[model samples]
Target: MVSDAVGAGEGAALRARAVGKTFAATEGARVVALDRVALDVGAGELVSLVGPSGCGKSTLLRLVAGLDLPTEGELWVGSELITGPSAERGVVFQDPSLFPWLTIRRNIESGLVARGVLRSQRHEVDEYLRLVGLEGFANSYPHQLSGGMAQRAALARALINHPRVLLLDEPLGALDQFTRMRMQDEILRMWQARGTTMLLVTHDIDEALYLSDRIAVMTPRPGRIDRILDVDLPRPRQRNDRRFLEHRARLLELLHLTGGIEEPLAPGV
Candidate 1:
């Protein structure tokens, strides 16, 4: 029962061209994190980046979040080149990372307060809380809620800013399996309502398959965009359906997760 999980008209086009990121390591050596990576996410779309450990998925997210600078190439949000972090792009990390001392209501409004606009924007706080299904918990402290609830609050906090692009770095990774599944549905709900573009980083293949409009598979360290596959399946995808399993098997082969690394490659369907 997922509505096509796309954003309304709230998203801004995102583009990255020949982007590269490198860091200095020990012994005067350097480590390249991302290399010649190029990608695009159309307005209101959901795209996922998936790869093995140390593959720079998070690095790419950080660059887009404006938390770090790239060594080469360019990144853009709609017409503007990304030179630094802006309120138009918001991020939710694996850790919800809510403040221990603040109530959910205060946490959600913290951003507005920081921007010195809380006085003018306070009326919107309750709306965003309800948007994430956290209205009843507004007064609750971070420790008073369960992992799933806190993540919801964190999501609400980010959404309240009306970011044009939402970056999710394994936001549901800490939840139990059941909670994770439920949160997936919740994410779709929010996406449809806000129409805000989303770029997600995840290790879960099924999660990518179920949520992404397209999946960008990255190579190991010094990560490159090895390939991007369109998910042509219909909404409310059945994880056990024939096509679903076929895509899953193909993805496993692409990632070398299956026992066969020599399997002939298939073009994206």
Candidate 2:
């Protein structure tokens, strides 16, 4: 039985007002990735974005992280408009793009080092290593670790900055089932411990249902919010529970409407 998942605290507030993005395609064509994508994330809340392929989930995340400017509208982190990347926000992509040349500790420390942390503050790096269950692997290089371990290092790198918000771009997509489930639990624990606001973009409905306070369903290309589902099932949710199955069905239905698999196989048979 899974224990109930708990919220960290009041999450930092974020708003995307009429945010939209367009890219110049080959041969003078233009591709609109997102349109009027407006959403709010409350302080300390874990909001998940789910959608069909080409739904611009990643684009929306980038907009919130301030890594890309919206073609129109604006994104705000609290009262300030986001202009560029800052230590205030951390991002974890699907690939655990750790530095192959650096030790796990060194890679995590690089974030602190970039902020000009003094030698005395280096203890912060070691603390985060332990936080991600990588205490013994500190000196190991990225290639020496397994996929899951590397991803944990990526997570450690993000958290060491003490970011107010963590943007996860399908960080667990590459992992197998067992590892993915374990990482899911670890992410929840970390969120509980840190109380930082998180926005996760994923293709997995079960993952969204298990982790998010609310799941935003999106349509295909030029993605816009299709519907928002408030997940009421208790945390540490049981994947096999009736309530969990019900939400999963609803999410699948919405995905179907967006031209995803018309019938997603039932949960684990």
What TM-score would every model get versus the actual structure?
0.92, 0.92
lDDT of 1 by residue, 1-269 (tens): 22233236899999999999999877888888899999999999999998877778999999999999999999999999999998889999999999989999999999798778899999888887877778898898999999999998898888878899999999999999999999998898788878889999987899999998998888776788887878889988899999988988878777774222243533220
Residue 256 error, candidate 1, Å: 1.9
Over 9-46, each residue of candidate 2 has an lDDT whose tens digit, in order, gives 53477898998899888799888899998899888889
Task: Score residue 59 of candidate 2 by CA lDDT.
Answer: 92
> In model 1, what lDDT does residue 15 have?
95
Error of 2 at 259 (Å): 3.0
Provide the overall lDDT of each model, using Cα atoms, as 2-decimal numbers: 0.87, 0.85
> Which residue pairs collide in model 1, if any?
7-195, 8-195
Best by lDDT: 1
- Residue 47's lDDT within candidate 2 is 93
Q: Give the C-alpha miss distance for residue 43 in model 1, angstroms.
A: 0.8
User: Over 4 Å off in model 1, which ranges?
Assistant: 1-7, 257-269
Task: Report model 1's TM-score to 2 decimal places.
Answer: 0.92
